[model samples]
Target: MDIPSNHSNHDALWLPFTANRQFRSTPRMLVSAHGMYYKDDRGHDVLDGCAGLWCVNAGHTRPRIVEAVQKTVATLDFAPAFQMGHPLAFEAADRVARLAPGNLNHVFFCNSGSEAGDSALKIALAYQRLRGEGTRTRLIGRERGYHGVGFGGISVGGISGNRKLYGTMLGGVDHLPHTLDLERNAFSRGQPEHGAELADALERIVTLHDASTIAAVIVEPMAGSTGVLPAPKGYLKRLRDICTKHGILLIFDEVITGFGRLGASFAAEKYGIVPDIMTVAKGITNGTVPMGANIVSDTVFDAFMQGPPEAIDLPHGYTYTAHPIACAAAIATLDTYAEEHLFERAAALTPYFEDAAHSLRGLPNVVDIRNEGLVAGIELAPRDAKTTRAYEIFDRAFHEGVLLRYTGDIVAVSPPLIVEKAEIDRIFETIGRLIRQVA
Candidate 1:
């Protein structure tokens, strides 16, 4: 095989959330993808085990999405989303709102997960102030939470590595203790039997900061990016109750778990919980385009609606808020999901997936395994102090024809909803081999 080369120097790009030097040295490049595999620049078919960063729920290059973009580009590619409006944009939002849980009937569009997070935080702050809670400026996040890299996101986000470089982020942010207790919860299957009491940490924060000044609490119904940590049994319910009692908004950052990763349409629905707002991206367009959404309830939307029309209800949005092409892709993605019944497919396949996922329990160095719906997290012991065994397995799997995602020592596999039983077998089989070979 010939060594691949970038047309220009790769260092100038300055990648995000990446080890630029390490990645540029041993670059893994993909040229095309279809169904459950990606054709790398080396012309090797790499099986997808992470659903392309937990998006691409429909898999890659679905014909509906391809055709949607093809025809849309010719008809109308770029249109100003500011003062001007488009029918496709409204149609997509209307459909999305209907699918989202509760009276989450209002949708605000942006370009990515970070934008969605920042926008939702702003909405929470602005909503409280608009409704006479102007003093409520504090935001709450859970430790180990991953809410993208925007300024407001970094403030409420709990990842130390993602925040340490940015200096003191937006102040007045408090964190709920993350519910990943490896000692009591190790090797647990599905939701852990213990740790429901961790939700009371919210009350402790409330005692110290006072709920009157807290604007919102944002958490991933199932935390991703910082490894996969599901909310403990009954934990999410208690959080919702506390937020209700204190008049603080609850925002579910569903950027990864939304769009059927959890079997249902969103984690909010899968777990029987609803939030004041939901931030979604990734699977919304099946990773075909860059788009995200801040889903708000009718109450929140109505609060903003009361102000003067010319004054602007909520002074937030991007120039690409509702780009015509993105709207077209999203509409087609939804239609494809309906035609294929992908969500129902994922739900039905969960038992099979869970069985296959948990079968890795006794592998060497394996410490824990957790699975719910189509998502699985296989954790291994660290090789050295601050060394990530997960990354080792990830590299081996990718080099051996499977693409899996790793954060520290945890390997997260949430394949596209359209994945077949054979592909699921392949994913785990590759992972099992990689685990036994490393160290």
Candidate 2:
């Protein structure tokens, strides 16, 4: 294959969440992608094992999504989301509401997961005030949780690294203990058996701050960016009950687990519990055009509806709130999911995926293997007193024709729902082979 000449300088662009100096020296540039593979600048096909950071659930370059975006962009590129209206925007919101669980039938669109996180936080606060609970201003997040980079998200988020760089985020935020008990749950498939009682940490926070001061509690049903930490068994339900008993809204940051990453429509569906507010992005448009939405339950919506019929309900939104291009892409993406039955496909393949993930348990540097649905995390022992082993393994695997994502010391693999059994084997086999060679 002939290599495409890359003449552009990489100095101008500052990549997010990346080591700029280290990455500029040797960049891993993907020129294009299709189906389950990404073609690097060097013209090598790298199997996508992380679903392009857990967003591209419907594979890559789907013709339907592409055509819809192209057609919509030509017809109407930009549409104001403030007071004006567009047909596609309403259509997309209705489609998303249809897929959302329980009474989560109201949708507010934004541009990305970060915006969704911040938007959800604001909505929670606004709803509390609307309901005459103006004292409920505090937000609760769990340690090791990854919301996003926005001020509100970082405040409620518990990942220290994400929070430390920006001193003192939104005030009155407390955290519940994360439920990753490695001693009892390591190498476990699906939800772990231990740490369900960890949900009580929220109760402790409520007691300390008083329930009236707490507005909402946000968590990822399965924490994704924090290294694939699945919620402990009964933990989600217990949290749901607590939030209910205290009259605090529960928000699930489903940016990573939404749109069938969990072999169901959403983590809410998989766990059989409903959250008052849910934030979703990424797979909403199959990682095509950027889009995110905060889905609110009917109760929350009804609270806002009591004001004036023509008055502004919530004074928040993005200029590109429901961009026509994103709306088009999302509609097509939803169509693709329904027609392909990708959620059902992922459900059927979970057992095979689980077995393949756990098969790496005895690998040289692997300390733990956890799998749930199509998502898996292989925790590696650190090297040279640092978390370098998984990073090296990630680089090596990319060269070996597979792409993986490493967070801290965990290698997370969550392939597209359309992935085949052969592709699954190839991904783990490549990782397993390269892991054995790690020093």
Candidate 3:
């Protein structure tokens, strides 16, 4: 593999979700990746702790996925998703629908998780209108939720920083309080014992605006980007019950938790509760190719089919909606998960992963440690300056030959599902050592 020639220059490109000036001054570049390790620009092996932004569940550069993408691009690179049809698209959508829980048997393709959010919101609104409930235009989200960065997503998303700079967002968006109760549920393993009552906040919101005006409620079953906050026991079921009673749609943004992150095929399966709609990305193609999708229930699809036999049902879709190569990559990714039994692998590793995570409980600056399945978040006491402690730990961990993700004051870990027991030990062990060193 050839490295980019301009290794020293960082002026032309502006990075996303990064401190541009700080990063340009001290860049940490990944040149290649394999299995659970990434080779940096200096050729140092850095143990992957975040699965390439929580996507590459099957590990890096699997031969089967590579072959699929290669064969696809060489044969049919692009296909017009509008009116024109492609075999791989149908095949990929079918595979995803089959993996989805409950009656979510229909799939709509998009470019990324952000697009998936926007597409799901549109589907909810459209589904309501098609059912003669055009008044149901309101959407509900939860505080601290990270639903990607689209206009529609940002509007309903409750992260203030992500929404502050961008003037007024969409109207009729309300947020339920976040479920993270550090004072009451800190350092608890798996789902915290408290906070199930927090789900009732939706009922309050529903009463404020009336359920007839609310179209859907979107949330991450296991909130990832805003720090790993798994839903409390019974919290999701309560939300599902509320949405069902009100005839409101429920959308689960499973971009990070989808494809075996939560010890099951999806978080819906892990909790035994099904959502009205599901948005997925990241692991759908095992991070080898860019793809996202919105899977809806049969009721939503059938409602759109009622207008006319030849009429265009939903007035939405992307140009690259099911690109042949993406479909091929997705098909191969599903095959990889099944053949390797990675979902079961994740479930089996939870106990060991939990113990390793909790072992850091007494480390300096460690305030909270949350773990579920293969994901864990170690929250540090914030420095006088916000985010300073977390960034320091992140930078130090990278230099010490391990890659970790830092969001706000929390250091998150979610290695590939293909990770071995030894690799898991190394990941948490390195983080524990780094935390002590920072002390």
Error of 2 at 157 (Å): 1.1
lDDT of 3 by residue, 1-439 (tens): 9777855668878899899888888999999999899999998999998999999999999999999999999999999999998999999999999998899899999989999999999999999998999999999999999888999999888888899999999998999899999899999899999999999999999889999999999999999988899999999999999999999999999999999999999999889989989999999999998999999999988999885688998889999999999999999999999999999999999999999999999989899999888999999987776446778878988988989999888999999999999988988888888788767
Candidate 1, residue 106: CA error in Å? 0.8
TM-scores, all models, native as reference: 0.96, 0.97, 0.97
- Which candidate order results from sorting by lDDT in descending order? 3, 2, 1
Q: What's the distance in Å from true for residue 393, model 1?
A: 1.2
Model 2, backbone clash pairs (residues 3+ apart or across chains), number? 0
Per-residue lDDT over 175-213 for candidate 1, one digit per residue giving the tens place of the 0 to 100 score: 998989888987666778888899999999999999999
Candidate 3 lDDT: 0.93
lDDT for model 2 comes to 0.92
Q: Weakest 10 consecutive residues, lDDT, candidate 1?
A: 381-390
Total colliding residue pairs, candidate 1: 0
State the TM-score for model 2: 0.97
1 against 2, candidate with superior TM-score: 2
